[model samples]
Target: MTTWLLYGATGYTGKLIAQEAVERGMRPLLAGRSKEKVQPLAEELGLAFRIFELNSQTAEHLEDIDLVLHCAGPFEKTSKPMIHACLKAGVHYLDITGEISVFEYTHSLHEEALQKNIILCSGVGFDVIPTDCTALKLKQALPDAVELALGFDSDSGISPGTMKTMVEGLGGGNTVRKEGQLTDAAIGKHQRLIDFGRGKKSAMAIPWGDVATAYYTTGIPNISAWIPTPKAAIYAARLLNAASPLLSSEKVKQPLLKWVEQGVEGPNQEQRARSAAYIWGQAANADGVIKTCRINTANVYDLTVYGALEVTQRLLTGDYPSGSWTPAALFGPDLLESLPGSGRFEIDSFYPGNAN
Candidate 1:
């Protein structure tokens, strides 16, 4: 009986989640800014939908909704309004956002969410679920952990929304959680060879959402997030950092944004089926103890659809607590393995002792 809404239900990932919801026999009212896109999909799926822009009047639409799965993003721009509306409407808020700023913004409203008795959980997707869970599991393994490193590599092609988010991030440099605080760092400043159960692949630190969520989830003060990157992309990111100011300008960003809008939607069915994601995480303490773990899962996009629906179903069944939460924190570290095609975390190594 939990009435929920799926916003941005027309986007690539959004559509996937929406379709999966129906296939699971769950009905979530679909919503988006464009009626043309939202209505057609709703009609095709035989589901109800609403069209509304993010504005002062947004909460009015959530009046009857118990939860909102906000799939629209560039969450840096889209999240604030939806969060505000959710708070106003006393609706639990969930989103498939991997943006650090969005995580931090939602975390800032933790008290308000607790007061409203509604949960605000974000990154219920490939973005931070695998990484966040890995972080927590490692922390649980090494209780006194002070440093955390996380990385992932996925073969799934990018969606337009993801590409836009990356284009927008060109100017923000990169960030790491240092001494329990978010600190700016040069993009690709830190590199390491991580064996994500396959082989040693070169990874470079990037501003992943775990930089924000993992800190809250595991209380690890020093955190770094990474992704496998080619030497050329690393060099390009360095150059992009040097030209950060220009990239921040609308004049420079608009064309790139337009290109993304006109380009590929995302991977097709074949690509989704063919792709896979690998994640690696480590936690270490000053005492020289380290715990390393890794997981292999379905394509990032496919996991997003599964993760989002799983979270939605759980919340509807009264499975999580109220307040701002990372996906791992709300569902525990085994959440990733609970999904289809996502296996249990393989504790690859333990320094000086048993991981358990």
Candidate 2:
């Protein structure tokens, strides 16, 4: 049997992925820090359950599993421990991590996993898939790109869990790749207004973890990512960024997570309605001429589910990268074709009028 491990199977996003797996007739081994939480989800989904609290015994127990869906995100709490356990078990590992620190940290495990013949990938979610896939697509049209700018905005309601993830990212350390070297960047350093097709809204260079994926996936030297959230959100995040000095205290983050968790009223019928992200790629080839392409998409949180489940399914089929890798490096431009078009992804290419 092709047994799978659904880590954090009880979390918000985890449950959806678990449901998807069960529907496919694959009963993954549901795992979580809490056995009580995992048991019912597995049973309800007609899957097996195993509680693994990131302990040595649990890590060893993870051995022999075909692959793991590392879904318990806000991964600062769960990712590393689970990865170490999966590495020890020699199992393939993947996660929807949107934090650069986690991605960088996972890359640290890449060489080791390769030597051991295991697979590890992060940001298999909306974070980089849309951005990464779109970048590759642009590269297909324009061979060499100097900068890639992504703007994602959603009118759709976000799961509090996803919000907590964002809060964690903002409150966590900040980063960007500069001069071909990885370094830290200030939070909210880049900001402006973005047009999401529907309307115009404020956009902030929120320092998404995608900076890492863009650099590694496309040889593009200059990359920046922005999220266009409502103005209220802008203020809240700015407050968080301004208070970064205090965010380091778990005393602060823990309560903040609790607060965000309380904010989850669940996506409404219209709330889950639709959302999108737009990525702009600017290229400069041998000449100094500049060209641009716009990559836009809708329903991003749902897209996260789509992309992540796609990767998870690939893992089950034994169609995946062998070791630690980013989604772009693993999936390439093909990922764009996989997205539900018309609503999910749209690429518009533009050039300066008379520059030809």
Candidate 3:
């Protein structure tokens, strides 16, 4: 039987993934830095549990596991050690990280992973799974496209882990792909009225992982990622860009982190069931030909559970290419279509026909 380990099993999102795994009759070994938390959950799920800090010893625990579903963050700190362990143990690696730096770093290890014949995939969650696939679908609709714009509206509450990750990057501004290079852009640098199938909504450029992953997947030279935000928040982001020095300081960031700690772990089951996410993408060539696509899916957190487990299950079946890969690159855009309650549409345009 293919066995996997669930690191950071006690986290909010980690717990959700664990529950989904159990519901699907999967019994992943629960591992984390804390026995107090992981032990209870493991017992509840009737699975074995292990506790280990991310270090040289991590490989010892991976001896029999085929894959690791790393859910802990901020991945900027957690991913390196775990990745090193996975590579050493010859185990496939996956994570739910939206951090662009994390994606870039993981991609840099493609050769190492290929050498070991172990797949390394990140951003399997709400971060880029939907957006990355949508970007590829748009690229298919416009094969000669040189520029791409992606947008999403997450009508769901933020989890504590997600908030902490966002707080850690407050002063770094946003990121966008220009001429196929990842470059910093001012927060709120670009704004658009994206028609997310529901209606036109205000969206602003953000340092979403797709700014990096989309380019890697499609080879699009210019790309931007956006998220729907209220007008007031957009204005605040503009001002925050000017005050980045202060915002990025520990003195200011500490209180914000504390404030986030007081927030809920994440959305409740009711909220997740009722909420929804909308995504839009457009690819264009120099001649002004454009191809657009839209995706409507369940709530962000809910989709995270499905997306993460779906990828995990697929990895368990064991025939994936060995290298750092984007979700779309590994599974194709039709991967998104397999998710329940997910829908995608491509607009008919005067551009080239669909590549797929």
Candidate 4:
């Protein structure tokens, strides 16, 4: 009888998670900043609803829940308050943020969560599950790996929430891990042609959460994560990098935020059903031995629902270690095997001295 609470239950992605949770016969208490928004969804799903701004008072609303699935983001602003609330209430906290800063901040709470004896897991979604598991599998294949590269391509459409988050960090630059340290690099500084078992596509380095999560998961000292993009987008990113000072200014960013507001909510069911995602990872050691693999998963949004729910259910079963954890770190590499239609292929040609 593990009762759960879902914050930000009115957003595009949050709605999807709620719908899926209901379909699976789990009733989560819906919560958000606006009772007007959450009330309708809660009524529609026949679940309880609560309204509370994310702050010190948030814990007061968590009286009856065992866990909280935080869907609110840009987590940079929302996570800290919600996490503090969860810590104070002694409730497990989980989130779907891909923001590396959020991950690091949450990880910083490991000792506090352990002291409270509650699990604190983040990136329990498409953000890093597939890539996190793939990175761990590659590490298993190349146990002595010193460097790791991971990339992913998704056909899923962007939600307004995702767009807003991306826009907020427009000129932050890309990040990569070097010798176990996070280093900032100019956007579009590293581009590669990655073949995700489908075909070659142009991929550019991004400050993905895996750069931080994988370091803790496998202890890989050097890591990079990429997302496929068009050539024009790469060039545009470079231009933006050069003009970051202007583009990042409030004068410029304000208009961009307005533009993003008019965008679509996210992929519709038909679009989500038609979409597919692919992930690739390579692990190499100083001696030149490399192990590469590709993972083919269903739609990104759909996978997010699946991954999040799976983690939620696992938490409900109890006995998990208390700490901030990445998906692979808590569940292991084979966790993806439970995902329907998810397949992994290890390239036999990727081996010692191949260097390709």
Which candidate number has the best lDDT? 1
List ranges where model 1 is wrong by over 4 Å: 352-356
| RMSD to the hidden true structure, all candidates | 1.7, 3.0, 2.5, 1.6
CA deviation > 4 Å runs, candidate 3:
350-356
Write out the backbone clash pairs for model 3. Answer: none
How well is each residue in 1-356 modelled by candidate 2, as lDDT tens digits? 67777787787777876776667666778888787788777778777788766655667777678778888877877788878887888888888878777887888887889877888888887776877776666666667666666556556667767778766654554465665566666665666776645556777675676677777777777667776766776666657776776777678778878887776654643554454555544445544545545555546666676787778777677566577788878877677557653233344554555534
Per-model TM-score, in order, reads 0.97, 0.86, 0.96, 0.96
On a 0 to 1 TM-score scale, where does candidate 3 land against the true structure?
0.96
Each candidate structure's count of clashing pairs: 0, 4, 0, 0
lDDT of 3 by residue, 1-356 (tens): 88899999998999999988999998999999999999999999998999999987788989898999999999999999999899999999999999999999999999999999999999998888899999889888888899999888866888999999988998999889999899988988788788877888788898889988998899999999887777888888898888999888999889999998885578899988888888788899988787878888888988888999999999988598899999999999988878876986656565445453
* Model 4, global lDDT: 0.88
lDDT of each: 0.91, 0.70, 0.89, 0.88
Estimate the lDDT of model 2: 0.70
Assess the local accuracy of residue 296 in candidate 4 as a C-alpha lDDT between 0 and 100: 90
